[model samples]
Target: MFAAAAIAIIITMVLALIRGFIGPTLYDRILAVNMFGTQTVLVIAILGFMMGRPDFLDIALVYALINFVGVIALLKYFKYGSLSIGPGEERNTEKSSHMDKS
Candidate 1:
């Protein structure tokens, strides 16, 4: 039933793409995109099994790693305004003291 599973994953991938495009918030879109990437990895694995080629698993693993890092980097950039974090540098934009309320 690998074919069935592949079909299911492709359907979910379509759904994820729709959600990513039509999400109400930035986080929602990011989550959807992440889901799509995960589905892609699954698809790759399934295809590899169907074709009897084990090498695709390696490519899928690499893609998964890239997807994870990409999402994390995107989230950090959106939250912190930059990816560069120097040692001992304070990047906290939130007010720490109660009296410092703006």
Candidate 2:
């Protein structure tokens, strides 16, 4: 059963990689990459259980947190060209506007 789950995850990961590579837009690619990262976390947890090592869950947790933060950062950068501040930050928005004009 675990093997079956792993195989399914592997198939999904492959599909996600393909999507990431062939996505029509940057957002599609970003979403595909995020999906891949999430699948990786699940795979790591499953592998840990199969190997009788619980410590891998810690790694999976860290990966998940990093993945969440990374996706947010990517989206923020795509929208504003930087993640230094929120969308309503006038100073940063002004800076970005200036940069765009350059």
Candidate 3:
């Protein structure tokens, strides 16, 4: 059963990779990459269970947290043009000022 689940996850990951490569927009590619990361987390957990190694769960948890943060950071950068508050806010303000001047 574990093997079956792992196979399914691998298949999903392959599909996600394809989507990421051929996505029509930047957001679509990001979404596909995020899905692939999520599937990797699941695979790690499943493998840990299958091998009776509880420590793998901890690694999987860490990976999940990192993956979430990475995806959020990517999206924030795409939308706001920076990950830091100061730079992002400054950019937005500059755009507003330019509009005001016009």
Candidate 4:
């Protein structure tokens, strides 16, 4: 059963890579990459169990965290064109004088 699951995950990972390569929109590709990362974590865990090596789970956990941060950074970079800006910082380059009066 575990073998079957690992095979399924590998298949899905391949599909995700295809999507990441040919997705119509940028967001679609990003989402595909994120999905691929998540599937990788699952596959790692499964492989660790099958091999009776628990250390792989720790590596998987770290990879999962890095994947999460990477996706968020990608989104931020695409949205704001930079990652140096803080969350509450204004993204616009120009401030309107009319709005400043209020």
Which residue pairs clash in candidate 1?
none
Q: Can you write out model 3's per-residue Cα lDDT over 73-102, one digit (the tens) per residue?
A: 998888777777544255646677678668
How many collisions between residues are there in candidate 4?
0
State candidate 1's TM-score.
0.81
Model 2, range 1-102, lDDT digits (tens) per residue?
889999999999999999999999998899998999999999999999899997999999999999999899999888777678687655444677678768
Model 1, backbone clash pairs (residues 3+ apart or across chains), number: 0
Ranking by TM-score: 4, 2, 3, 1
**What does candidate 1 score in Cα RMSD to the true structure?**
5.1
| Candidate 3 vs 4: which has more TM-score | 4
| lDDT (tens digit, per residue) of candidate 4 on 11-51 | 99999999999999999899999999999999999999899
Q: Please identify model 4 stretches exceeding 4 Å from their true place.
A: 95-102
Q: Where is model 3 poorest over a 10-residue stretch in terms of lDDT?
A: 85-94
- The estimated TM-scores of all candidates read 0.81, 0.83, 0.82, 0.84
RMSD values for the candidates in order, in angstroms, are 5.1, 4.3, 3.8, 3.1
Worst 10 residues of 2 by lDDT: 85-94
Off by over 4 Å in 2: 91-102
Return the clash pairs for model 4, or none.
Answer: none
State the weakest 10-residue window (summed lDDT) of model 1: 93-102
**How far off is residue 86 in model 3, in Å?**
5.9
Candidate 3 lDDT (Cα, 0 to 1): 0.88
